[model samples]
Each structure stands twice: as structure tokens, then as C-alpha cells.
Target: MANRLQHETSPYLLQHADNPVDWYPWGEEALEAARTQDKPILLSIGYAACHWCHVMERESFENPDIAALMNQHFINIKVDREERPDLDTVYMAAAQMMTGQGGWPLTIFLMPDGKPFYAGTYFPPEDRSGMPGFPRVLLAVAEAYRNRRADLERAANDIQGHLTEHFRWSLPETAITPALLNEAASGLARQFDEANGGFGGAPKFPPPMALEFLLRYRLRTGSDTALRIVELTLERMARGGIHDQVGGGFHRYAVDATWLVPHFEKMLYDNALLARLYTLTYQATGHPFYAATALDTIEYVLREMTSPDGGFYSTQDADSEGEEGKFYVWTPEELEAVLGPEQAPIVARYYGVHPGGNFEGKSILHVPEAPESVAAAFDLTIDELVEIIGPAREKLYAARAQRVWPGRDEKILTDWNGLMLRALAQAAIALGRSDLRDAAVRNATFLHTHLYRDGRLLHSYKDGEAKITGYLADYASLIAGLLALYEATFDVRWIAWARDLTDRAIADFWDNEGGAFFDTSADDAPLVARPKDAFDSATPSGNSLMAESLLRLGLLLGEDDYRQRAMTVLERFAALAAKAPTGFGQLLCAADLALAEAHEIALVGDPQVPAMAEMLAVVQQPYLPHQVVALRHPDQDGEDEVIPLLAGRTARDGQPTAYVCRNYACRQPVTTAHDLAAELGMAVE
Candidate 1:
């Protein structure tokens, strides 16, 4: 029989709906059931793409004996961590507090009133290798709850107190300066593994945020070391098995420091961030490698992750057909079958596909040799080699398509979609790709129509239904995307929508007393404590993104209030950011903007002018990290909305003119791109 989770929209929850164990979706009903029955809640939290989540579910949740034990002893509750990050955040913190580490599938034993007395990650069905089995832990927890109630209560109280204590910040404020950024750069340099081209040892996650910080630091201070760090890390990852060479996009973190073996799951957030990072690096250095990688990543998202309605899907699972990485790995025999013997060796040599594969007798394709070296060995030019490899890759991709593809979680998350949307919009401008612009606009339309309700936004959507109140991440990231969309298309409606969302977010999630945005809104369901995340993890923190959005929108809208709020957030988090600038990359970005020379480019003329393209091209060309551009068409009437940056700006001598303003001081308007570049201190090509 199906459990209560059958009705849930989260794919993770729906996956367990028919489990022999009766599972309740987290809600008032489940809470009431625990309270009424006086039984501890067995809360299991995991996401759809988590491989261990599937393992635990198959081994324990679906087993009849264990299901009977769970049903008789506890109120079983299942939660999709991706769908309800608020619950995940609060409980994950508690889990870490009690166990000293935390991961999913997160197992927690909660008291009747919703306090967790015990917490752990995955547990096997039977005790093995000194680890207690799930059944053993279950029996012990139930026994403890029944016989040693006071002890359990005391532990829960202590855990709750520690959770509260963790959120409070007491570090003294340090003024953000050039030296602090240098310190961050130096810190990253020390942590960097020069030989492997990543930070630290095994299990290497791509440091997209850290790379972003390094890029900005290089741009700001002309630090060659910082630029080298960014270059080496990106190039290493691009050539490593972590990147999908036959297809496009990257797998999740590499298990080895050399980036040779990845975890196999592809997340929307990681790709979105890495794509934008690559694009920015390309713009900053005019590097073809970065641009190509960015384009390929974007194409991968378009092909596999995009929804028919335009929103991006959540994730692609790590495992397929009950085997991890089965869908991605390839044997040399399979490669030869697809490419034939003659062409197979050349492609194999280039992609490191040996008979004894790098991963469990099946190759994860990667560039072990340089393209020039491979070309030299093949007695062909690099370009000629690439031409042959391209078609061969397509043939292999087609053959791989015949295999059982990995499961996809089609749930559209507002935060991840927002990040992707922002990436596409920014890449569209930098690469001048119309397709990317269209996709960004279409995605914005999807968010506007499906995820947004009457004057508010929902967090996740799937199968034509939107549910859950929007979190700070949803509001901040979506507004950031909308702001970028406005910049890309010069459509004021997007700017208007961004403003509206920002205002609503401030009302709903802003901590008036604490001075940073909360992860959950004030009116959200009560947890052990409200989450006010400040540090960036796999995704940028909501509070950090909120601060950045406010700053950019405030500058673009010429609203002092928004800027003031942003300053307050920066001030509140400055000390924490200074303590570890790399972890607070988003906040560091906002601080960089706050401290840099604020430049606004107001192009006063008809956007349709023949010269407008050249002027806009120049604006897009310079990697001006702190500049905001707004179009002020001369045809605007009183009825049309006006942005502050565009106010009192008009064309010079009846022609399209560009005004470069620094720190609110406008320079003489220039009619030509070259002249405008000179005014902005950019060398015209």
C-alpha cells in the first residue's frame, strides 16, 4: 500500500511512497500523530539524486521486518531535503551538533514535541564492521525513549541550545580593505594543491565561489598568482574525468584530488555557477578555452536539464540500473564498437581510455594528454584532430543514449532555476548568443507564471503544481536572475519584477533586529531555531545573495534605501567575512562593490540606433565587475516607468550618447564607442 507521501510533489518522497514502512510527509498531521501516539518520530531526510538515500531505502525502508518495527515503534516521517531546505538546515545543524558530522540520508529520532534526541546518516540493515544496524539503533532509541525519557529530554534540550548558539555571530567588525582581499588570495594559494590544481586532498569539489573570488581579486589588484590559481584550477577540471568529455557539463565532486574519479551526480546549481565563472573568466582574459567550456556547459543544460515549459530541473542521479556511474562509464570494447578499430585508438589516446580503465574496468573519459601532443602523435594538426574527435564523440554519445539513462529529478527549484537563469543571461551578453537570451527570457516567464502566486513566490514546482512558501534563497536568487535578465534584454519589466520581489523579500525574510536575511520567513513553520545562513556552501548563501542583489538593484534603481539595507548587511557580516573571505565569496563580492568606485553607464538614445550595437558591445566587452548599465530611450513618456540611473539623461546632439558616471559624478557624454571606452578608462580594440 502507498503511504501518505504518495501525494507529495517531491520526487524523493514519491520514490518511497510505496515502501512497506508507512511514511508520513512532514506536516501538522505527522506532528499530531507523534504527539497523540507519544512516539518518537523517525525523520529521514534525503534528496532524490543521493545514491546512499536509495541504498538505505532499498535495504531498510522497503524490508518487511524493519518496516513492521518502524511502524510499531515510531511515527515514520520522510522529507526531501531539496524540497524543504528549512527543515533540512535546522535538523542538519542539530545532527552535526550531536554526531560531530552530518550527511544524508539524515536519520533522526525526534521527541513527540519535535526535538531530536538522536541523529545519524546512513545505517545498514544488519550490524557490520563495528557499526550498529538500523534495526539495532531503532530498538535502542525506542527503548531509551520509553525507559529513560528524562535522559533523552535532557540531551534534546542541550542539542537545541547548541543549535541556537551556532547562529549567533560575535566576531568584531573589520573594515574590508585591499589587504584583506590579498589575505584571502594568499590563503587560497596556501591551501591550493599546486600539483593537482585544487585545494587540499581527496574528494575534490570544484571551488567555483573561491575561483570567482580569485578572478575578482585579480581584476581588482592585478594579482598574477590569483589569476594563475583560477587558470590552473579551471584548466585541470576541464581536462579531468570530473567533466563529461563525450557529453558536456561536470559530474559532482571528484573522489580523487587529481579530478580523476567523480561522484557522477550532476547538479543544476554546480553547473550554473561554474558556467558563469567560466564566462566571467573568458570575458576577463579573452580565453577561448574558458568560452568553449562555458558554451558546452550551457548546451548540456539545454539538452538534458531544461523542462519543456522552460524552468530547469533539479538534478541527474549518480546511479543507474542499481550501479553507480554505469550510465557514464565506458569500456574500450564499447568505444571500439562505436568508433571502429582504426579511429578508436586516436580517440582513446586523446581521452585516456585504456584497456584497464581508470574506474572499475570502465573508463571515465578525460584528456590525459594535451591536444597538441595528441595531434603530434597522430601526425595531424590540432584543428584536424579536433574535427575528427568531434564526430566520434557524437557517435559515442548516440550509442550511450541506447543505454538506460540515469534517473532525473524533474522538480524545478526556484533557487537553482534562478542561478541557471542568471548564468544564461550573463553568458548571453558576453557570448552574444541569442539562443541563451531567449532561454533566459523563457525561464523568467516560466517563473513568473508557474512559481509565483498572487504577490508572492513559491519555492518548488513540478507536474503543473507549485507549493511551499519561497525561502530567502528563492527570493534573492530569482531577483538576481531577473536583474541580469533586465540587463541582457533591456526590458524594464524584469527590473520592475526584481524590485517587487526584493521588496517582498525584505518584508518577509529580512531580520529587522539581526540585520541579515533569514533562511525561513518570519511567518514560516516554527523549527528549533530560524536559520540565517551567512556562509556559502554548494550554493551561495541566501543572505549573501540578498545583499548582492540589493546592492546591484539599488545602484541600478538609484534607490538609497536598498543601498542602505545592503550596507547594513555588509556591516553585519564584515567581520565574519574577513575572518574567512573565501567561504563568504558572495558577501565578499558585495563588499567589493560597496567599496569600489560605483560606475553607472546610462546610454541616452534610441536602442534601435545603428550605432547602439557598437556602444552596447563596448559596455559588454570590458570586464567591469562593479559597473551597472541602463538604457534610457529618448522616446520615454511620463506614463512609462523611469529608473533612477536613467533620470535626466538624454542624447547628445540628436544622436545616441553614452554617459559614464563614476561615484554619482557624470562625465561628458560620448557618441562613439571608442570615445566612451576612453571615458571609462578602457582601451578600445
Candidate 2:
């Protein structure tokens, strides 16, 4: 029978609707019931895409005996972490404190007032591998709650105290400088997997933000080593099984350092950030491979992850057909059946498919042989080989489409869509692809029309419903996307919307006392703690993203407040970033922006004119991460007033012109692309 989770909007919650466990969605009623009945709360938090979450559910949550024990002793409340990150943040910290590690599905025992007394991750139905059984753990916790209430209460107090103390930051004695960037760059260089093209060992996650920082470092100092690290990592990732060679998007992460075996989940934010990273890499190196990879990744998202309303989906599950990687893995016979014998050897050779297989008796397609090697072996040029592989990949993709697919989480998250939004806009501008531009524009419009209501942004949308008050990540990331959209499409409305959102975010989420932004807005419902996460994880922290946007928006409009707030955030996190550079990737990039010579450009002309197109092309075509390009129509009003960079800018010699500025001081106006490129220290044909 369906539990109370039947009425929940979250897909993760709905997954457990028929569980034997009498689950209550986290809400006031559950808390009130717990308080009235004097029962401790059994809080289980996980996401739709988590593989172990499904494992635990199958092993324990489905057990009727375990359910009865849980229902008798505690008020069971299930939470979708993605849906309620605030609660997750507060509880996750406590979990990490109680246990030395943390991951989903996070299991915690809490008091009625929301203080967590015990915490753990997945537990088996029966004790195995030295892990305690769920039934035993439940009864033990319940018994302890009855007999040792004071001890549990003391432990809860201690955990909360540690949670409060862990996030506090002291202002660094020194301000941000080039030396800091140099140190951080050197630190990343040390940790870099020189052989494997990633950091550390097994379970290598893609550090797009760190790679982005390296790119910026290369741009700032012309450090070939920094550039090399970015290049090698991207190349290796592109050729690995983590990247679906046939399907075009990437999986969640590779479980092995070789990037061979993946966890198989595909997340929107991962693809989004990777698309932009590849696009930027293409711009930096003028490599056709990076450009093509970017296009392929974007194509995958559009084909499988986008909704009818144009908002991007959250995640595709790691498992399908009752087994992980079943849908994606292929056997030698299957490949031969799909492709004729003549092409099978060539395709298999290129993709490293052997009869023995790399992953659990099935081939996970990866490029062990370089295209040059494959081309030489096939007695063909690179172009000819690419042409053959293109159609062949399409056939494989189509064949794979017929199989049972991974379950997709259809909910749209504002921060994740924001990442995709910026990616789309950047790809469109870099590659001159109108399809990406159109998609980005459509997404921006959808966010505005459906998610943004009465001058406020909502966090998530699913099944024609938009709820949840906007978090800091939502406002900051969406604003970043809007700014990119403005640059890509030259629509001033995007800029206006971005600026308004920035101001709203500052008002709603800025921590005046802490000198950084909180993850949750103060206007939102209270949690055990108002989380102010600064270090980057799977996504950039809200504070880090806000600092980035604030720096960019500040330069574009000459806003002192924005600049000052950004500096404070940088200074606040400087000590921590100095300690662990890789974890603070986004913050380092923002700090680079703060220190780099500001390249702010103002163009006054008709955006559609050929002369303007030439000038804009010069501005768009390079790896300029620290640039702020603001375009204003010759006839537009109020833009000049709101945007100080546009004031007094005019066309030169009756032709569309560009005004290149450094630190808000302008050089002479230039009418041609060549001159504009020269002014900006760039070369153009």
C-alpha cells in the first residue's frame, strides 16, 4: 500500500510510496506527531539518482519486519535531499560529526525539536561485511532513546555545537594576491594525477571548476603547465568510458582512476559544467576535438534530459532493468549483430571492445586506440575515419535506444538549470550554433515565466508545479546564466533580469555578520542551522558563485557595493582556500577575477550590423575569462543610466565601434574588428 509519500511531489519520495515502511514526508504534521507521541524521529534522506539509496531501500525499507519495528518506536520521515538541501546540510554535518563519513541514503535519529542524536549511511537488512543490521540498529537506537535519553541529548548538543563551530571562518590576515593564485596553482599541480589525468586515486570525479580555475590561471600568467593539466584531463575524460562514446554525454563519475568503470548515473549539472568547460577549452586551444565534444554533450542533454517546457531534467538514474549499466554496456556478439562483420572489427578496435570485456563481462565503450592510430590501421585519413565513425555512432545510439532506459528524475532545479543555461549560452556564442542559443533563450524564458513569480524565483519545478523558496545557489547561478545569455544573444532584458536578481539575492541571503552569502535565504523557513557552505563540491557553493557573479556584474555596471561584497567573500575564504586549493576551485577563479586587470568592453551600435558583428566576433573569439562585454543599441535608453560602462560610448566615423576599457578607463574608440582586437590585446584575421 502507498504510504503518505503518495502525496509528495518529489520523485525520490514517490519511489517509496509502496514501501512496507509507513513513511511520512518531512513536514509539520510528522514533527507534531512525533512531539505529541514522544517518539524519536527516524529521518532518511536520499536522492532519486543515488545507487546505494535504492540498494538500502530494497534491502531494508521493503522488509515488513523492519518496518514494524520502525513504526512502533519512531516517527519515520523521508526526505529527498535535492528537494530540501537546507535540511540535508544541517543533518549531513551532524552525520559527518557523529560518524567519520557521510553519504546518501543518510540515516539519522532526531529529537522532536530537530536535533539529531545518531546518524549513519546505508545499513543491511542483516549484519554483513562488519556492518550492523538495520533491524538491530533500529532496536538498539530505540532502546537507547528510552534508557539513555540524557546521553543521546548530550550527544546531539555536542554534534550541533561542532556543526556551528566547523563552518565559522576567520578573516585572513593577508588580502588576495597573485602569490595566492601561484600557490593554489602549484598545489593543484602537485595533486594532479600525472599518469591518469585526474587528482588522487579511485572514484575520480570530474573537477570542472578546478579545471576552469587552471584555465584562468593559464590565461592570467601564460603558465603552460596549467594549460597542460587542463588539456590532458579533458582529453582523457573524452576518451574514457565515463563519456558515453556513442550517446555523447558523461556518466556521474568514474569509479576507477582510468575512467573505465563508471557509476552510470548522468546528472544535468555535470553535463552542463562539462559542456562549458569543453567549449572554453576549444576557445583556448582552437581544437576541433573539444568543440565537437562540447556539441555532442549538449546534444545529449537536449535529446534525453530536456522537458517539453524546455527546463532541463535533474538526473538519470545509475541503474536500469534491475541492474546497473545494463542499458549502456554491450557484448561482443551484440555489437556484431548491430553492425555487420566488416565494420564490427573496426568499431570494436577503435572502442577497445574485447571478448573478455572491461566491465563485468560486458564492454563499456572507450577509446583505447587514438583516432590517428585507428585511421592509419584502416588505411584512411582522419577526416574519412571521422565520417565513418559518425554514422556508426548514430547506429549504435539508435540500437541502444531500443533497450530499457535509466529512470530519469524529471524535476527541474534552478541552480542546475542555471549551470546548463550558462553552458548553452557559451556554446552558442563560441560555436555560433543557433540551436543552442534558441534552447538557452527558451529555457531563460521558461524560468522567467514559470519559476520567477512576483519578482521572486522558486527553486524547483515538476509536473506543472513550482514551489520552494529560492535558495542562494538558485539566485546566484540563475543570474550567472542570465549574464551569459545577455552576452550570447545581446538581449538587454537578460541583463536587466540578472541585475535585479543579484540585488534581490543580496537583500535576501547576504550574511552581513559573516561577510558572505548563506545557502538558504533568511526569509525562508528556519532549519537547525542557516547553512553557509563556501567550499565547492559537486556544484559551486552559493557564496562562491555569488562572489563570481558579483565581480562580473560589478565590473559591467560599476557597482561599488557589488565589488566590495565580493572582496569580503574572497578575504573570508582566503585562509581555507590556501589550505586546500582543489576544494575551493570556484572561489579561486573568483579571486583571480578580483586580481586580474578588468577587461570591460562597451560597444555602442546596432547589434545586427555587419560592422558590429565583426567587432563582436573579435571580442567573443578568445579565452578571456576575465572579460565583461556589454553591448548597447545606439538608440536604447535607460541602459546607459543603469550601466555606467555604456555611458558616453558612441560609434566612431559613423560606423559601429567598440570601446575597450581597463579599470573603467577607456582607450580610443575603434570602428573595425582588427583595431578592437588590437586594443584588447588579441589578434584577428
Overall lDDT per candidate, in order of appearance: 0.89, 0.90
Runs in model 2 lying further than 4 Å from the true structure: 171-173, 683-685
lDDT of 2 by residue, 1-685 (tens): 8999998788999999999988998889999999999999999999999999999999889888999999999999999988888888889988988888999999999988788999999999999999999999999999999999999889878877777776655555459998889999999999999987978889899999999999999988999999999999999999999999998899999999988899999999999999999999999999998999999999999999999989999999999987999888887788889888977878888898889899889899999977899989989898988787788889999999999998999999999999999999999999988889999999999999889998889999998999899898899899999989989987888988999999999889888877888888877867766788898888888889899999999999888899999999999897678668889999999999999887899998887899898888888877788899988787778777767899888777778989989879998988888899888876556
Q: Write the per-residue lDDT of candidate 1 for residues 1-685, one digit (tens) a residue.
A: 8999899888999999999988999999999999999999999999989999999999999999999999999999999999999999989999988889999999999998888889999999999899899999999999998999999999999888887777755445566676666676778889888987878899899888888888888888888988898899999999999999978998989999999899999999999999999999999999899999999999999999999989999999999999989998887788899999988989999999888898998899999988999999989998899898999999999999999999999999999999999999999999998899999999999999999998899999999999999999999899989888987988888988898999999999877876778888888888888888888878999988988888888778777889888888788787667667658878878877888787888887776677988899888855778889999767765313557777777778888999898655798889998898888787767
Q: Could you list the CA RMSD of all candidates, in the order they appear? A: 1.3, 1.3
Give the 10-residue window scoring lowest on summed lDDT in candidate 2: 165-174
Least accurate 10 contiguous residues by lDDT in model 1: 633-642
Q: Which candidate gets the maximum lDDT versus the true structure?
A: 2
* TM-score for each of the candidates: 0.98, 0.98
